[model samples]
Target: MRNMRLAAALALVFILVTTVFLGGCGQKLAVAPQQGGLQGLKKLKVGLVFDVGGRGDKSFNDAAYEGLEKAEKEFGDKIEIKYLEPSAGGENRERLLRLMAQDKYDLIFGVGFIFTDSIAKVAKEFPQIKFGLIDGFVPGLKAENNISCLLFREHEGSFLVGAAAAMQSKTGKIGFVGGMQSPLIEKFETGYIAGAKYINPNIGILSDYIGTASDAFKDPVKGKELTLKQIKDGADVIYHASGASGIGVLEAAASQQKFVIGVDSDQSLPAKEDQRSFVLTSMLKRVDVAVYETIRSLVTQKFQGGYQEFGVQENGVGYAENQYNKELIAANKAKLDELKEKIIMGEIKVPTSKEDLK
Candidate 1:
């Protein structure tokens, strides 16, 4: 009886060990690979959320999408891309965050300053998930180990446009149409005015901040009305940094037979083939470049979480070469070329803020 009892005890121990081993093996098989070595066997899922303007604006959101598309092409089986376009005042911010968390996305990116608050809250709730935020800063909010903040020196690019506008304007008067009166929008205005003055101190600037922070960039009717008034004020060239609302500014410029400067992307391309005459130039923000670089960094395990700013020094922002303007202003092209070289060479600094204006 003692021998039989000992044998049973040994048998039970063996069975328990086998069961634990098999269970552990199964769990290991279920867990996805966490590093780049298994990229071929598994895909890294990524999600993006666009702000109120959404896609088809041919500007900010579209530029970000371009980067995401590039990643899909380059990473192949290594990545899967997903996106969300929030409707006006969309409450899906938290919903999207929850979806990303539940779906086990490897990384998620949020576009626009408006989503800063949402990102902050989501980042806190999911400490294990990684995130990227564009165009805004949250102070004292400790982004988890997996979060990164990307910012652009829009003022730097805007300054160059301002200088170009002042130099190219047949009319001494120039105007600015900003979508919102927030600090971000003001950055564009401050840099532009400073750049204009740098070129010609006497240039008359007609500036108007269309609406308060919340409503400023969304009101197309106000954009058109403000732009029309600027045209009537004898401003032949106007710079618009008003998101989708800038479309109205472009239309107004076309109707008035005046030149308009575009923001974020190559707006000149969006203008009708015949209406191309109205777009003098566009400020290239290179949001696509930033997004692409960030993704590449993650793939390479070079992800640095904090703040990064892109500027002319990094070739991250500038003005598109005005192919049309070059032909029209053939005689003046040399001056523009000289100015570009000077700015690039650091001989001439382009002012991009109110402090830089003087």
Candidate 2:
């Protein structure tokens, strides 16, 4: 009987140990790749090069990071991912693209329009490598049938912010500060002005562009100066499509105790708690979602080339729902929601280019 009891205890110990081990194994298997899916797709290497703002802007760059993170999580062991931050004067873009091509990455994504010329040039040289360009396009550039372009309907989101600004403004005057006067930046400004006019034709707008694309988006000092000037000119609300330079606009707004709208992402989250008071809302452009979706298509062998647009119709861009400032006028929210539904239902069409504006 003693021998039997000892044997039983040993058996119980073995069972408990096996159960623990198996439980852990099960957890690992849950996340493990399936027999023939993306799990089996090995030797996959991907690289992403960010545009001028780099990662900390908490707007465009951050969104792109989120998409890359999603790709990392889903692809797991089958893929290796890397990112490059370009320096001033676009010095790093060509070097990094060349390095990525030399490294034989399976896919490379260039994050902004600044890379249009570089990518167009590099893609032609590295014909066998697959490339994804975001926010810009390279016409007549062919890369071994492996290049794709991703564009966004930024004007669509800008329109929403314009409406929001118009409804929320205590003063009828508003301002738009663009990083550069490119056709792309004008898309945002034109859509915004149209939206404001849609609400009230008499709404006054002060618009200015910061000069060159590279300098326009990074000059916080200039952004601040322009924003203050607008405020003094009777503009109570301001919208900035100026990338990192928009930081100055937000700072100026906070200093002046005025309201400011953001672009690309929810700036309130990144702003200091005190500064957040002036951030009324953000025009959220899900560039990250676009990046992730494009990568996902490649992972799943569903990559589609040509132009892809993200808009309110695709849930790609919109205004933040006043999470930080719950005290927004109820009527304003209601009106915005009504307009959103109309836009979604085809009763209202948001402009895509400046030419679309009436």
299: Cα error in model 1, Å? 1.8
Query: Can you give the TM-score per candidate against the true fold?
Result: 0.84, 0.85
Clashes of 1: 1
Model 2 per-residue lDDT tens digits across residues 1-358? 9999999999999999999999999887776655554547565888999877788867677888888998899887667899988887557888899899999987899988888888778877987777888888877543235678888777777887898888878889999999877888888898798788889889998998877657577788999999999999999999999888899999999999989998888888889988998888888898878888888887777776666778788888888866686565355777777777777788878776666775
Candidate 1 per-residue lDDT, tens place, 1-358, comes to 9999999999999999999999998787667444333544777788888776778776788888888899889986677889997757655766776688778887888888777888888877887777888887877534336678788888778878888889889889999998767878778888788778878999999998777764455667888999999999999999998877888888899899998998898888877876678888888888888788888877776877777788877878888766665564455457656766776688876555566565
Candidate 2 all-Cα RMSD:
9.0
Runs of candidate 1 with Cα error greater than 4 angstroms are: 1-40, 140-144, 328-352, 355-358
lDDT of 1: 0.80
Error of 2 at 273 (Å): 0.4
